[model samples]
Target: MSNDHGDEPHELRVSKIRSGTVIDHVRGGQALNVLAILGIDGSEGEEVSIGMNVPSDRLARKDIVKVEGRELSQDEVDVLSLIAPDATINIVRDYEVVEKHRVERPDIVEGVLSCPNRNCITTGDEPVTSGFEVLEEAVRCSYCGTIVREEIASLIDTA
Candidate 1:
């Protein structure tokens, strides 16, 4: 079925992966962030493909990331939820989608984000891991109660 744009029917521009994860419907402009979260530098010998600002019926514009020969860990997916909550994860094997689901924001996020508060224990030399309560518009530090509402990309602890 052709759309009103008269453009050719949308197709997967990237080749299918033998086995890996395909993150689709990512918020437009956030595909690079997803790649960052995945720690894929494109130098690790894995086939990685990214499509940004792609057309989407649900989001109008979206991004997609295809990683060949690897699957995302739960921690990685959790971090993704913070950046692209509405994104869908597709587990592809043998060029077929075996599993598909949308990413969900967990009630508690840990270790992935550094508390913005300087005095927060997470920032201190102590061994406390950062913890936050997932809120609708912000994440509240469980230690210092500091609410992080913006610039989440900067606050993410990729270590």
Candidate 2:
């Protein structure tokens, strides 16, 4: 079946995790940001595999992240939606996909992201946690009313 067409059907195989999570359909070039959101810096011995700017049918280009030995929390997945709204989270167990779901935006996010406003109350010495109300495409600081619409993942404080 050697045809003259330059295009040919193909498939890529990424290793499967025995137990953990696989985040698929991430917006291309945001794989590093996804790692940051999950607090993985390579210093904590997190087993991670990433494929960026890969060919996709659902998107022009997409990224995939496979994290070993860990399942994401609801709060973590909520923040993920801020960047990769179309991502599909797959929970693997015993080399099988035990569960799969899409990330949903949360109404509020607390104690996860750092407010950029230096004068905001959450940045002060007072014992107050950061809070933000999730918007349609952004997040509004609950304390200082600062709206963040760009580089949302840069405000992530996984520490």
Candidate 3:
């Protein structure tokens, strides 16, 4: 709405995804990583729209990725959690949000991913797997073993 004082109406940047998921609240600089993990590029060319360093009321700066005509699998969501835990996944169909979910990290992470550590066995070419157990709300990186503690996970403060 325009103000009587001659102030222009604020423009809202809203777009339709057509189908698939809209991942919002992704931490800045992590959108591309999430996209890579989701294998969005491996699939047939889908309309992928990304907005980085967007202003957020909740997070001072946030990122968003919208993929068209593709619904993400549960495994994909789990991968998203590893990189963007505060992410909000919106299932969009016909330009409407059909379902919304907050990404949550699972307790025991299996073959789902390789440890982020470069020197870890999982990161090696030779096919050694890394597994972890959630001991007291922290995910321990089993191989080159380190802990992403609950406190670290909970520190989503983008301010």
Candidate 4:
């Protein structure tokens, strides 16, 4: 029994932002993690929209995050790539996308993530930031050589 309306065009599922950035093609079930990466917890009252586990052509299902009046810095983007490698960053102004680009995995990340190793120097009271070298499937701490792969989102250090 075919009721048949599959070919009809669909309207936008999520509202667009007047200015800011839209992170598209995030892997399914990771939108909340992406928000965590962006440091948005609604305390600051940021205008944000999230589409989680939405149907997608590329990933079968994907997540999208839209932030109004905010754009991600290089450090934030680099960290975002750790989880959402296929994500495309779209800068919007006046409800139009001004620039669109994919997140590139950096060779080395610095002063962003906190090393998980408790004994690592960076974790001490010293004025040192963490550094990690990106690996094929994990990130290795430059200080203690600790390797982290699973639940990379949980390892995000927003401090």
Candidate 5:
């Protein structure tokens, strides 16, 4: 609480990342979405921090996610792009960002990355593995064998 009205200073909470990945420029309100999509919740004892609506030159207002002691796998990166497509992945070591990568579309997607169709086999009792083929700019579900056009394929936002 500052007594000065117009010139009051704001407190900023920032933590240091000793190692692992620092995902920046996540779309506003989607950092946790990216985390859930990446299956970080299932990682027992793994430390993770998420910041939403932070200031950024690239995104203006954006979300950021920092994962400690773990590196994102290729599959995880693909999942991230599906949710927060414009995010940047930064690899940090010794408190320095050693590598950076912009999210890119993957050639194909496998397993139950997303529910193919509400009535598809993968969503039924059989628990069949789902697959998809990346078309020019879309991913087609191979189970029901339906093409999930890019525009319509974005409905699978949940983890």
Candidate 6:
């Protein structure tokens, strides 16, 4: 709806993906992080589309990511949950949505995130994978009891 100034809202039109994944309702500004988690920098030769700060009724604003000709792996989805918990994954095949689901944070996250504690076993050459217990507002390192509260994107291990 327009305000008293009589300015009409413009519509956003994004092309549909024929056979790939469409992530919608990304927490407004986390689309880039999602791309990073997928290791997609637009240099891997895939058609990647992103819409940031789009109007949304549920979130007031949201972001959307569309990747053509590729499906999201479980690991990628897991990482996305940490950044955009309310995001939804849409599998499009032949320009039709074949599947749709919301991203869920796993109880146990491993390898995707690096523990903030430098003294943790995962940080040294102990050959232990980084592990964390997913909490409501933060993730706790399973080995060192260090809690990560912010800069989650920087801590994501895209390798």
The regions of model 4 sitting more than 4 angstroms off are 1-6
Query: Comparing candidate 5 with candidate 6, which one achieves the higher TM-score?
Result: 6
TM-score of each: 0.89, 0.92, 0.71, 0.94, 0.73, 0.89
Give one digit per residue, the lDDT tens place, for model 2 in 39-124. 99999898898989998888899999999999999999989999999999999999899999999898999999999999999988
**TM-score: which candidate is best?**
4
lDDT tens readout by residue for model 5, 15-116: 878999988888787876776676666558778888888776678889988888888888778756766678899999998998999988777767636654
lDDT comparing candidate 3 with the true structure: 0.72
Ranking of predictions according to lDDT: 2, 4, 1, 6, 5, 3
Q: Which ten-residue region of model 3 has the weakest summed lDDT?
A: 150-159
Against the true structure, what is every candidate's RMSD? 2.3, 3.1, 6.6, 3.2, 5.7, 3.5
Residue-level lDDT for 142 in candidate 4: 90
Candidate 4 colliding pairs: none
Please provide, for model 1 over 42-119, each residue's C-alpha lDDT reduced to its tens digit, 9 standing for 90 to 100: 677778888889888899999989998898999889888988989999999998999999999989988888887898
- Residue pairs with clashing backbones, model 5: none
Inter-residue clash pairs, candidate 3: none
TM-score of 1: 0.89
Per-residue C-alpha lDDT of model 4 across residues 1-159, encoded as one tens digit per residue: 222457666768799899999999999999999999889999999999999889888899999999999989999999899999999999999999999999999998998788888999999999997899999889999989999988888778887
lDDT of each: 0.87, 0.92, 0.72, 0.91, 0.73, 0.86
lDDT of 6 at 68: 96
lDDT of 2 at 86: 95
Model 2 RMSD in angstroms? 3.1
